[model samples]
Target: MKKLGITLLVATLFVSCSLSKVEKSARKTVDGNWQLNSVTYDEKGVFNTHLLNDVTATCFENSQWFFRSNNSTGTYNILDSDCSTGVRNFRWAANEIGKDSGVFDFTLKFTDDKKKDIEKNTGYRMNLKYLDDNHMQITQTIQFEGKPFNINMNFTRTTL
Candidate 1:
């Protein structure tokens, strides 16, 4: 009976570690500042949309972003004078879908500066399509006209 109890405890602890191989790799590579170079759709056409349930899609272009892998928290600044000009804080995670698969289930939860959740039970999930030291791409697929439409947000690492 004693051995069984110890075995169960060990199993629980192993499962609770949580971070997968890909997630750890992604977090390390994503730590730093980045510039949102563009927002594009997989299909060639103009479509109006909002990103991360916030401002218009156009507002994300050329925005500055910062990610802290240590705490999984980040901030983005919308610099367009014509649009909302402010910093938005968010908590994010890169969850690996399979064992060392290089694919991740990315989730973002908007928060206040104090790191309090802005909305209860509400957040966004996207796919971490690609990531490297200098570049990263995230895609959110939504239903448009009963078909899947992909919204891609591209980012490039920046200094300072």
Candidate 2:
């Protein structure tokens, strides 16, 4: 009876662990180029608006590098998505194009790009809202210079 109980316990632990991890999967299968749909403040005393649309950005782990741009040369990366955190881990070559004045002065993009390994491991809770089949609103809330800001990006996929 003791041996049987131990075997059953081991089997149960394995199944439970696997089951829990499955639910931890990121909310979306984020493995492609997505546009900067819309970024909103969603907070009081905050001013925000749509800056760009259908920005070209590619997310491919197997590619030499992922690329993101606004119809011109913009940002790219060979990114790994934690379908668990929706955080895209970039390998190399990421850029923020265009000039815009927001509540945060577009600083989040730069800060996220230069994060260290220890910091990158702790993923942020990404809030991305899907509109229709190919449209999405990506909102990244982060702290820059010891102040919190939310950048709302709106985008639609580009058609070839």
> Highest lDDT: which candidate?
1
Q: Estimate the TM-score for candidate 2.
A: 0.35
Clashes (N, CA, C under 3 Å) per candidate: 0, 19
Q: Candidate 2: deviation at residue 132, Å?
A: 5.5
**The CA-based lDDT of model 2 is what?**
0.37
Off by over 4 Å in 2: 1-7, 18-29, 43-122, 142-149, 155-160
Model-by-model lDDT, in order? 0.92, 0.37
Q: Estimate each model's TM-score.
A: 0.92, 0.35
The sequence of per-residue lDDT tens digits that candidate 1 reaches over residues 1-160 is 9999999999999988868766788999999999999999999888999988888889999999999999999999999999989999999998888788889888999999999999979999999999999999999999999999999999999998
Q: What is the Å distance of residue 34 in model 2 from its true position?
A: 1.5
The sequence of per-residue lDDT tens digits that candidate 2 reaches over residues 55-129 is 222222222212232111223333335312133333222122222211111212222444334344433344444
